[model samples]
Target: MNNPAAPPSLLPANRRIVLSGEDALRILREIEFLLMSLNNIGRHYYPDGDDDGADAERRAQYCAETTRFIDAQQATTRLALMRRILSAQFDTTLGDDEMDDIERAVAALPLWRVPGQ
Candidate 1:
């Protein structure tokens, strides 16, 4: 007896959000790294080095010209959200050594002060 060929199958359409504590920690760490990099970029562009009136004005204009991607309000809001999520969802002891190092970096960030510390 001849067997018929199987029909082609369609791809699955359903998606799931499988976020765990570790995933949350990694996300928070990435946000910390992003903020740190942005701060460094800002300092590089807007230096307090000695400059005359015209030079300072030129540098100011240059800084504005160069820094088009930075969104201060968005960064602030994201950082706040990251902090809140990390505190609420994840425990500090649940991470590995790499996360430990990232946690230290996150702690040292000067923008957000730890409460009751």
Candidate 2:
């Protein structure tokens, strides 16, 4: 089966896909869910309560790293959702200028290192 997430250019030109208001709303809801899930993961990484013997510096670092990671992921997801919405609504792929803006935004995001990586 063809991948639903495939970019418009990857799909057959003869095939036209249109997203209704309901479809777009669903995508927005999915983004909200994704944000919540990422937030939960961040909380898991640094939960409230006792330090569990972890040093304050290490805990602060973890908090910073996790927040950066989640922010990056959220930004990327929002960009992808914007592209998808534009593609479905306009029946066109993003132009180079628009894509360049997205690339710049993503590149400006602070880098995050995974724990132990």
Worst 10 residues of 2 by lDDT: 2-11
lDDT of candidate 1 over 18-116, digit per residue (tens):
458776787767677777766665556556643343367667765674455346436556667766654554334423443532254454345645897
Error of 1 at 77 (Å): 3.2
Q: How many clashes in each structure?
A: 0, 0
Which residue pairs of candidate 1 clash? none
For candidate 1, what is the TM-score? 0.33
Mark the regions of model 1 whose C-alpha exceeds 4 Å error after superposition. Answer: 1-24, 43-54, 62-67, 89-117
TM-score of each: 0.33, 0.34
